[model samples]
Target: MPTEKQPVNFIESALETLLIEQNALKILSTQIDDRFSQACEIILQCKGRVVVTGMGKSGHIGRKIAATFASTGTPSFFMHPGEAGHGDLGMLVRGDVLIAISNSGKSDEIMMLMPLVKHLGVPLITMSADDSGPMPKNADVALTLGHLQEACPLGLAPTSSTTATLALGDALAIALLEARGFTADDFARSHPAGALGKRLLLHVEHIMHQAEELPKVFPDTPLNEVLYEITDKRLGMTTVVDHENTLLGIFTDGDLRRLLDKEQQFNVHTPVSAVMTKNPSTIKAGMRAVEALQSLRDKKINQFVVVDDENKVIGVISMHDLISAGV
Candidate 1:
């Protein structure tokens, strides 16, 4: 028979763990000395990509650090130390920077790879608790993460040490990102498949309804004809333009609803210009889709006209298009 599990106080346990990690992070902050600056300098000076490597728990942290660097405009990748001793060592080049992570500073796999890394004339940066450890002594710049007791009751698991290492890695990555003048658009290019990239990289031109697909009406067009354009284009709105196709105003579902609610009798022969909102919200074709979305959200409106420098309607954008494009 399977053993019956007792109900554990999970929330309390989680809080305690968080408190311990917070304390550990506070301790780690005090040790940011000259070594940290040295590491940053080495990375900033590198012409080639950053190569991160470690063993076990440190390996996991190294992978995250490599990913953060890569996404933030720094070209970087993680190399397994054990595998590096095999043919993987070929990945390291002369101008590259190597970041080795080990809390104990005695990981044999890392030590074995250090000489080959040195022989390749690459700069090495090490993160370890012991400044005198073999890896740190061999490195050109040593960032000491310092000693913080594990949050684990037994003091055996990685715990606080890994957390400190990860934090230090994040600090390095972000600092370098700012130094390199990395922008949101640059980050989006690296992460093109995700929602963040869609928000940063997508523009009005990519999602707006253009040409004949846009719901538009001439100023002299009948009010009922404008209704037909709105229904046919299915954007819940239509733009009013003049003889030159210059945007004049917009008529939306809200406007129609209000008109109907007020019981206003409209002559079918009347022009739409009489009731449309003049100089409606407009966006440029090159504007980011995310910015357009925010504009619509702020105004509590669902549609905007994409206009040229002369204020001529080039296209139309809607909340539905932004949603469908994952912006």
Candidate 2:
């Protein structure tokens, strides 16, 4: 006798779906091999952009993949497969690499554009599950997906399959990033508006006090004059410099407290150099502000002199400046 169908248990179905998808990813990882390396090499050799294209669900994933690649150092963008046939294919050029995503490897829109892509001499890297499909057969490098059953109970929607495709795209992008020796600075340059960008790209010069705004005095300048500079500039410190503006040392509010604690007097006639801390922390204008902040914390100091290569103080930065600059 034929068994009766069980009622759908939504919670159990959801958990099962998650399990299947995660398992599918594990299976997909095992399939990565020489073909993956070949694809990365082709992308590395590409002087032009990585043009990612696909249809439907694959297209959505392709957009994210394109964004990931662009941010991580590879120049890439998503192109709609349907749009490719409608004159958009003109955007692709020689030296470009095409990353085509189609779960079955036989998406009509992607397949139709393959001929033009090949004619343009663009290296094709295909991501798909169907080995028998013509798309993988013709690829310069084919990233094959492990054949896995869909997480959908009815085996209809692309559940595990799309997850596997997305994983493969991430794998390719990150591999290429490592191959290019992509760095945090490179990533920050591409994402300047983000917090990490500000931290890495905003250097000491951008936030430091410059020119007349810098609280400064010569070594022989009276302690009273140094106090006026620190008070007038409101930076709570002054750079002690030579007549040629070379950084000799620094004087801070903390130094004032230590002096007062010792009951030191004869304030007005005291030479600034007599009490100034010599060889104080200094940073170059070109160093990132976040690094400057780390230096302050490391040395237990609140401010740093921004110097030139010749070690002359051009500017000064406080912990307040780095905090204000979002470093």
- Which candidate wins on TM-score? 1
Off by over 4 Å in 1: 1-12
List model 2 lDDT by residue over 38-114, tens digit each.
88888888899999999999999999999999999889999998998999998899988999998898889988987
Predicted candidate 1 versus true structure: per-residue lDDT over 167-196, tens digit per residue: 999999998899999988788888777888
lDDT of 1: 0.89
Q: Residue 207 in model 1: shift from native, Å? A: 0.7
Error of 2 at 233 (Å): 1.5
Best candidate (score: lDDT): 1
RMSD (Å) of each candidate, 1 decimal: 2.8, 3.7
